[model samples]
Target: MKVIVGLGNPGRIFRTTRHNLGFRVIDKFRKRNGLPEFKSSKEFNSLLSRGSFNKEKIIALDPKNLIVIHDDLDLPLGKIRVSKAKGAAGHKGVQSIINKLGTKKFFRFRVGILPQQGKPQGVKKFVLKSFTRKEEKIIKRVVEETVEAVEFSLREGLERAMQDYNK
Candidate 1:
């Protein structure tokens, strides 16, 4: 089974932060696919929704068949990239997952959160801050496109998705 994981801190306050883009994408993907609402999974320490896509069974979390969606500070806002077997590049959340899974071979759908102006002064504070009204509009579009990229990855293949969306 394929497992898609959206990494983010768990809390209402983080719901709209740049750091929670992963959660937002997963939420939208779930709703768009008509999956049931996520339920707490103690064994996995995450919210999970189980279903099938294109006749393939999909569970919420697993290592071998994993696809992680998360925010990337390096790329410009609204940019999307699909990669596999790559290092976390200082993303603590991704590093934590790598430590737990003992490998970096899984797929990743990275949505850029950096503004076009440049990197922010304080990385921690910037990531946790809510997007400005102007930025929110861009984020909305990125989320939609990211969702489509993910669907393309599943329908076609990771390499093809990377070629198409990583432009």
Candidate 2:
């Protein structure tokens, strides 16, 4: 079963921040695909939903079947990269997953959160701040594209999705 995980901190304050892009994408993907709403699971420390996608039963958390979607500060806004077996690149959320799973042999959909102008000073502060009105427009489009990419990856294959979407 394919297990898709979106990395983001939980809190109302972080709802619209750039760091919550993963959660945003996951919510959109879930709705678009007709998945049920996530329920909080204290045992796993996550909000989870169980459902099938493309006739495949979705369940469990195996490194081989895992796909993590998260924001990346390195790439320019509106860009996405589909990678596998890669390090977290200092993302605490991704690092935490890597630590728990004890392996990096999993797929990742890295959504760009960096602004077009340039990297801002104080990344911690910047990631927590809400996107500007202009930036929000771009983010909305990116989120839709990301959902499509996830669907494509499931329908086609991770390698094909990477070739087509990782531009």
Candidate 3:
């Protein structure tokens, strides 16, 4: 089965924050695809669902896919990266999943929220703050793109999704 994991902190406070956009994307997919509601479990820190898209079995991986969607100070906003194996780059959420999963074979659909570069504090602040007015517009576009990328990921393949998105 193809797993789509979106990383973000758990809690109502983090619900609408940019840091949780990945989570939002996954939630969106669940709603759009008519998947089941999110049932919280220790193994999966966040909400979850399971269903198919375009005839492919798509799993709404919670805590399972969280790590892969972590912060990448290396990537700019609007760029989504897919990887099977890599360090957390200091993102606690990602580190948590990697520690729990015991394997990187799963898919991670990472939405870049870190500032383009410079000002090391950007990363520090990103995970804590909400998106700005301007960034909200950009983030909407990125989220839409994320949805498309994910749909394509299932229809196409992980490698193709990587090549197309990890640019």
Q: Which candidate has the highest TM-score of all? A: 2
Write down the lDDT of every candidate, Cα atoms only: 0.88, 0.89, 0.69
Better model by TM-score: candidate 2 vs candidate 3:
2
Per-candidate TM-scores read 0.94, 0.95, 0.82
User: How many clashes does each candidate structure show, in the order listed?
Assistant: 0, 0, 1
| Residues 1-167 of candidate 1: C-alpha lDDT, one tens digit per residue | 78888877789999999999998999999999988898888877777889877777898445657999999999888888899999998789999889988999999999899998899899999999988899899999999998898888889987888888877
Off by over 4 Å in 3: 60-68, 116-125
lDDT of 3 by residue, 1-167 (tens): 55666677788887768678778787777777788887776666665566777886655444433324444556666678877667676777777777777755566777777565533665556676777787788787887788788877777876788898877
Query: Candidate 2: where are CA atoms >4 Å away?
Result: none
- The window of 10 residues in a row where model 3 has the poorest summed lDDT is 62-71
